[model samples]
Target chain A: MAGELDVGYVAQLARMHLTADETELFQKQLGDVLHYAEKLNEVNVEGVEPAAHGLPIFNVFREDKAKDWFTPAQALSNAPRQANNLFIVTKVVE
Target chain B: MTKRELPALSIVEVQDMLRRREVSPVEVLESLEERINTVDDKIGAYLTRDLTAAVTEAKKTDVALPLGGIPIALKDLINVEGQQCTCGSKILGGYRAPYTANAIEKLRAHGAIPFGRMNMDEFAMGSSTENSSAQLTHNPWDLSRVPGGSSGGSAAAVAADIAFGALGTDTGGSIRQPAALSGVVGFKPSYGRVSRFGLVAFASSLDQIGPLTKTVHDSALLMNAIAGHDSRDSTSLDAPVPDYAKNLGRDLKDIRIRLPKEYMIDGVDSAVKTAVTAAVKQLESLGAEIVEVSLPHTEYAVSVYYILATAEASANLARFDGVRYGHRADNITNLFDHYARTREEGFGAEVKRRIILGTYVLSSGYYDAYYLRAQKVRELIRRDFAHAFEKVDALASPTAPTPAFKLGEKTADPLQMYLADIFTIAANLAGICGISLPCGFADSESGKKLPIGLQLLGKALDEARIFQIAHAYEQSTDWHKARPKTIAEGMKRAGKAGEL
Candidate 1:
């Protein structure tokens, strides 16, 4: 059942770096979870609309108004790494 | 009042005393603080506490307000300004909430003091609090067993009398399951009933913040303070907020309660079935019509929930890439490596498992087959409840398959843990309200008394009906009044464990 999906590829897609042991462990567990989820295929969903939300809310718009919000200091207060009032991340293209 | 009696008082009782000046706010806070110091070591219900802040808030308490001086615990997932909001995950360790959640603001506006931060499954992921990286929250009834989660700490705290009432988020039975296991009242309001403005998002569509309390009346009281529309949350409903506590004592003479056939499966525990069956009979005796209903698509609830929840979770959790906030992997040479290693080290196993499953299901080739199909089936599941509602005012079922199992029993198998939420998940998927309250108790093989829960579900925005039925059931039975013995009482019997 592990052959149903590639654990390595999915982990990469999720931006998670799994070690060899983790990959092996997750492969089996994910296989079981997905296998159990295969029961969904038994239902006939022809012409059924996909429900993106539980309610029938659509196009919820609010008036564009300027309101007082969190300042830069408050926004950056929880940043793990901050420099010059800006969040610091590793350079993408150097 | 003595500190020993403080934990057992309900919100209504505490409010009455506060109104009479019989117990000051500071006295109430001190009593809970003392109780937590005494029993928290055994129960492990709180993740963090700001007693100093709570004391300050208590000093300013105005007893004239509706919820004046009531101490309520906030599940770590909900932000309280200037307090630690860990979401019970290492990824968010050392992070402080910049502002208060909408519900927290409402609680404060009504004079409810946010006393302590309760533990939960990391980001509300697993059914059991075992997935929490911070600490294991034990069942107050039996410390060896789990308290059901991701709101395990909230349920445990309320059950153990640490908090009069607490708030919990139910993405997929997180609140109700734990509440059921811990012998407390766990309510999940309709999806849009409460605003999600500052509550940490698990699965945006399914996530709802509700109350775990000692009585259904307290749940309604808490709901009155918290339920309403908030402009900050786009999905928040604009409907008129009902006084949930107003119609609580109403009779259920004309109410039609449905028993879903699919929920009464053979795999369910005999004790759970028997207790819930007896509770249903009690409902019938109280002058309600018990009608047989069929939710044929109930079997697909777990399958659909896992697919849809993980898919939504994958996207919702992508913000924890160690860029702006939360844990940052040290010694990172590049951006991609930073993101990869941070999540790897920060998240627990179950979180990673779901993230991977979510990624796989939403991937290009598998999108239509997995994510889209699950969403379509989810529609059918929602329709099943809608049709059932046309015939009955509410539905009744067992909250969990069994009483609390041993801590390590289901951890090895994720599917088994998922099955524990089999009865509670459908309500969340359908965006309806549900409650888990103590119906009866079942004895374990060792003769330890474990509490069983009976879940009552209502259609969307029909929480008042559920509350009426639950309140009626709770009033007729003494199950809600049954409390677990303190850790000291249990230790006196065994003489080996419970050394804090």
Candidate 2:
């Protein structure tokens, strides 16, 4: 069964605001996609486990140590707006 | 070979010429410049190029190294230090990379020059390069047709003879589908076979960076350069990298190839089916045994992929909110409005659609019904491949259901476009390696020749086995030798056309 999607609510959750036209369009398109995905219900997944990854990757860890990486300037190079080596943004606590 | 024809030659051909001092890397860049200036106007394969720096690097390079001084175009998503890393989205309009990708680092270590930036579907979300916010890439075979995406620019550049070779990522069929449509050799190594340290994530578990080149041997050479472990990418395979070119020219005497019944669905174009069918017979003639196999859950692959890939994409792309690098919204209602409006203004429709659907699936109420269900089905899909692998050495199928479709043919219907990846999506789900190489040509209704690709899938980390089979077939067939006729015309326009 295709879940009923509230495009406006979903868009808000995704941190996006779709136009009226975009909402209607995506709603239909995503409806078809979700409907197609309903085919998953045909198979029995009762005893099956979800795949963790496409490959069987073993444990990968590194010792806690700092290595040479990009400097503050390099990291801030593409910042849309910067000040004192920090990224600028709209006020959140106002 | 004369300098006029230098850019059109394969990596091996150019490597030989450079090592013998017949032509310098500077000469190769010059020839490429001429070709690109002439052809790229119609092809639109490159988003950006840095030939001055390329020539500078080439002049100092040692042609004696394995990939010494050869130029390989990069899909825009792969970051190179100090270069613009636009993943074909307005969100990343002016962002430049702070560090190089591990793949690029390895390629540079092998003496390869990564110069040009190729276009792709915006964030590699679409099947046709039409989704690129930068420019639309056209098929070299027919200017009106599309080069498959999201590596369309990479494929078109190679097909147009403007790029010697290119590196492209395949999450779903970004590399192979485009390679098929453009008539080149594209290989998607096993998941984690190549490190993805600097690759912008789409679906982290599904994405693998690979090569799109003129021949099977060229792809092998590229794999030797880029495949290995990296602690930076925890998922990268810690396995030994093999000489991918070492098994070429070997006979397929004992190799067993399986023809999956599910791949030849009713929706497949008759021409593509005929081409793949003939390719199977050709392999048999080469002394390989052919067997029929069934991937029972193959039908569920695309559905699983869309759900899981989009879910991962939603989470992966969450970092694009207007806080750091990339486009920041000027609209200042509040903190939330900044992120919402910035993404709305920055991302394209298809991207937003995926993000919405992705967020919805992983949303509180729909998690088990969509995301988890898809993963469980994904496990079944993986088991189907595992079961088939127990009996056959490799599986064969059509790389794409059909050759290149016309521009805007399926854009209005996103589902139709998603179905285009039907044949190639399963490999990514199963975590197997696959290669698409030219097998035959299908004449379009207007009588233009379109290349068809035959895909061969091998078990995890079995790139060598698949390469051997593909190389043997490539050597046996003349299909790989045919280049798009527009190449010569483009070269002529550049005043660089001449016989070798």
Candidate 3:
């Protein structure tokens, strides 16, 4: 599909692997999606403001304070592999 | 009681039995186990059923929790403290969550036992569960057909009697559409009604969590248990949480339901139209003033939803870099290889497709034209709903364009799958509340019985009125009582039952 972005690098950056067939399949699908997205280009935003939400979006943050949480053991219980209160994983940055 | 018979039990009935000691929590949990074991294989409704863990929890509770002894299904996207949270993809296959979602915490506090995780579309992207990339959850009524997806497993699990109710998230039609297809009640509350603290994100602005159950009253009960202002979820609503279960089954003599003319356009199946029209008549007979309205921008909802949904999904799913968590590729030649291989290995075809589409739309020089514009269209769609509410109390439409389609029928074509959600997508795009209720049934010339759902959309936070109309409708009809017999027949082809 023409004008399709080569997202291969980003997919790789995200630890995703796409086969040649999938890459090709996605290129077409993504291109079509973007083509359809071009309808958004028709909207006039000149002198119009961009709003984050239709309704007011407020930061409903809780007061910063100490709070109790489950012990590290409980949190790591579902990790496929964990060691010494940390989730074990392969090295990323060399 | 046979497990088959147990699927028909309402949450209130089950809880009442528990309160009276007529059914022990242990016995209820055991029956749920038997039901899950018996039907889940054919329906593919559950990812994991923690029989031992649920039993342990039930045994520990000498005094029943409010929802104790009541079985419930959890959508796989949410993290359960010690259960695998796959998000219906291979990438996070066998991945367990370290902490429970805040909503799960609330359910546990209310004594709800998590029966198991239900299936979903991979990363909650597809309108059908076919994208699960693990198992295809057949519609409980018709094993050969799909249970509407992303939350297909949860919908099927409840519809097939594996659980009295289930929790599912909605990005597009993940919850409501599946509920419609599966012959159950599914509600997607206004965004942030339920906390999103632990749900795997597909589209943040569009995502919501709600109940899928056998009845409207059950959904209301579950919503009351889970809906609240949670500090952990920034988008969580600070509005006062109403007792959703209050005023359920009330008279709707003054309730005005608007039938949007835009939804009844060409391409809708004849049977779906017939069923929805019949349902409208039924609603009219019960005192609802049916009015005609127009959502002029309705035609563009799917396009806007796709763009915005993919863009947000692309950004939100970036955490699975194979390094931080989930499947990682070994022997990485470099950082790029690790990312590519892990994502390739971890995510399935559908998830990857959305991620790529999202990346393209949000990429440099494309952001304003794609993401920004879609968001604007999204605002317009919401305004359309708001404008119509001035004319009526709620909007009604067919939940899907048609009944459940054959398995593998549209999996090869992503556009067809997206189109299946054409009707329900508008609700999610607008962030309004909507519920899909089994209103009627259709008989194909081949003599197959398929359930048709009618969707009731209410203004944001107006779940009470939606439940009122749905419960009233169910009382006037026996559609909810007509369970699909094919679930037992495992009868290879879709089967026919007495039609509504």
Candidate 4:
């Protein structure tokens, strides 16, 4: 909750290619949320453990056997582009 | 029964009629289609509904099953195999789910017919449905106000009598707030009570699926069909799920309901505060011992929730990068540029704002200061519940600080909108079960009677207890029996605006 928010840096990190107007607007809005969240610093949490989730969950092992799964055609059903059961995307390596 | 009359009935009533062979599933579909046709043009509660497909599926309804042939509307984020799972974002435009989610699979297996494509805030982010690029869903109580979101469509449709029951996801008050605003019964099951395998993820840790319906008993019926352990959702509790409807119709003989003074703060609307106080007094009259309690950390719940929820949301939503499915940017030769450009265009203003805020809090320099501190504070909030529940059967509070506001009331100020959910978000933060049911109505400035809700919070996996209490209160009052006056007005408005 500390430090003035740099919307440009955060948006870049977030992959939100914002326009100038969006950048200016988000800077002010995100600043307000962060400002409101400054109240968290008041609570003393010196020795408390951080809870990753609401409940404590230990990993469970499922039965190690083959099960009904999405077929290749099914997996490719919503693909923006598909060829030979493979999802097509822009070339990663030029 | 007349097709016009069927849509107004509850899930239980329709199920009884269906079981007695008084009306077939086909009739229910026709009835819903008629009602939705009459009112939905003004409400904007649905993105799409396939009557042809629904009628065909209804033809095979089996009344012997619990939800058999009963149509339960679904919030758009939930996936039914091959159905559009847009989550009200243009990013998922033209995207159909590849397979069904675990909860829907359970519901479908129990003979429930998956009905309409209910609207929502894109990715279930906003408290008001205004953020949805799909359409603005107006409150059924007043044509000019909002149906609270991100389950706006789900709540409005049920309140408007277009559907008997609905499935909505609550991550920081999405379900309960909307239900309160729309004057319907909405229950957010304790986290892990329902599986999230098929839900489009938003703030993963806080997200939960729940029911919005006409009555508490109907919520319990829908909960029974969908809630149980699923091996698919790793966080789902493997513990037993009780029949949520079994202990209903009981008096609160020795139940100790607590009143958290922190929730009765000064900022709450006088009408809402008075109504909630009366509801608590009603419970006391029913033999409940009202004990005043304190959740000292209640002041920090919203702060902790925004920090943690947005942090998780930023990561979960990173999957939508114009690659596998949904909107893909054209002429983006660069792969990285493709993700950036596509998201900016496909997502709405609110979604992007949360993502950026989320990314900020979780980013390197601020990680320990914001995210870690919030997690620790979250533990404090949870401990408050753990201690309070040790002595009480449930905690009573107003669901939202105020009744439904006009459409653009809080839209410009995002932080003000976030504070509207202050009362209900803590239950989600603590990972406990909570239900919001109609307690009374408040007169809006327009002289329209807007519904206010009474919220009951129970311990983890204690949905049955709260349902029992809520059902008793609902049975004793005529609040749930009140219907909106907007249908005829909507028809008149729709005839004129072609745009209402």
Over 4 Å off in model 4, which ranges? A1-3, B488-500
Local error of candidate 4 at B481, Å? 0.2
lDDT values, one for every candidate: 0.90, 0.90, 0.79, 0.90
Write out the backbone clash pairs for model 2. Answer: none
lDDT of 2 by residue, B342-448 (tens): 99999998999899989999999899999998999999999998989998989999999989999999999888999999988989988999999998898988878
lDDT of 4 by residue, B129-173 (tens): 999988999999998999998899999999998989999999999
Candidate 2 vs candidate 4: the DockQ winner is 2
**Lowest-scoring 10 consecutive residues by lDDT in candidate 3 chain B?**
B490-499
TM-score of the second chain, each candidate in turn, equals: 0.97, 0.98, 0.96, 0.97
Question: Which structure is stronger by lDDT: 3 or 4?
Answer: 4
Instruction: Give model 4's TM-score versus the native structure.
Output: 0.97
For model 3, the docking class works out as acceptable
Question: By TM-score, who's the top model here?
Answer: 2
Judged by lDDT relative to the true structure, which candidate is superior, 1 or 2? 2
Which of 3 and 4 is ahead in TM-score?
4
**lDDT per residue, candidate 3, B1-500, as tens digits?**
44334445789777776788776788888877876777788988888777888888888664356677676789998888778888888778767677889888888888887778888888888877888867888887777888888899998988777788999998888888999888899999987789999888888888898999887788888998899988888998888888887878688899999778888989888989998989989989999999878898888878888877877888898887764457776676776676677777778888888877777667777777767777777777777888999889888899999998888898787877888888888888777899999987777555668888899899888878888888888889878766777664432111323323
Can you give the DockQ of every candidate in the order shown? 0.86, 0.83, 0.41, 0.81
Chain A fold similarity by TM-score, each prediction: 0.89, 0.93, 0.81, 0.89
Candidate 1 lDDT score at position B255:
95
Number of the candidate with higher TM-score, 2 or 4: 2
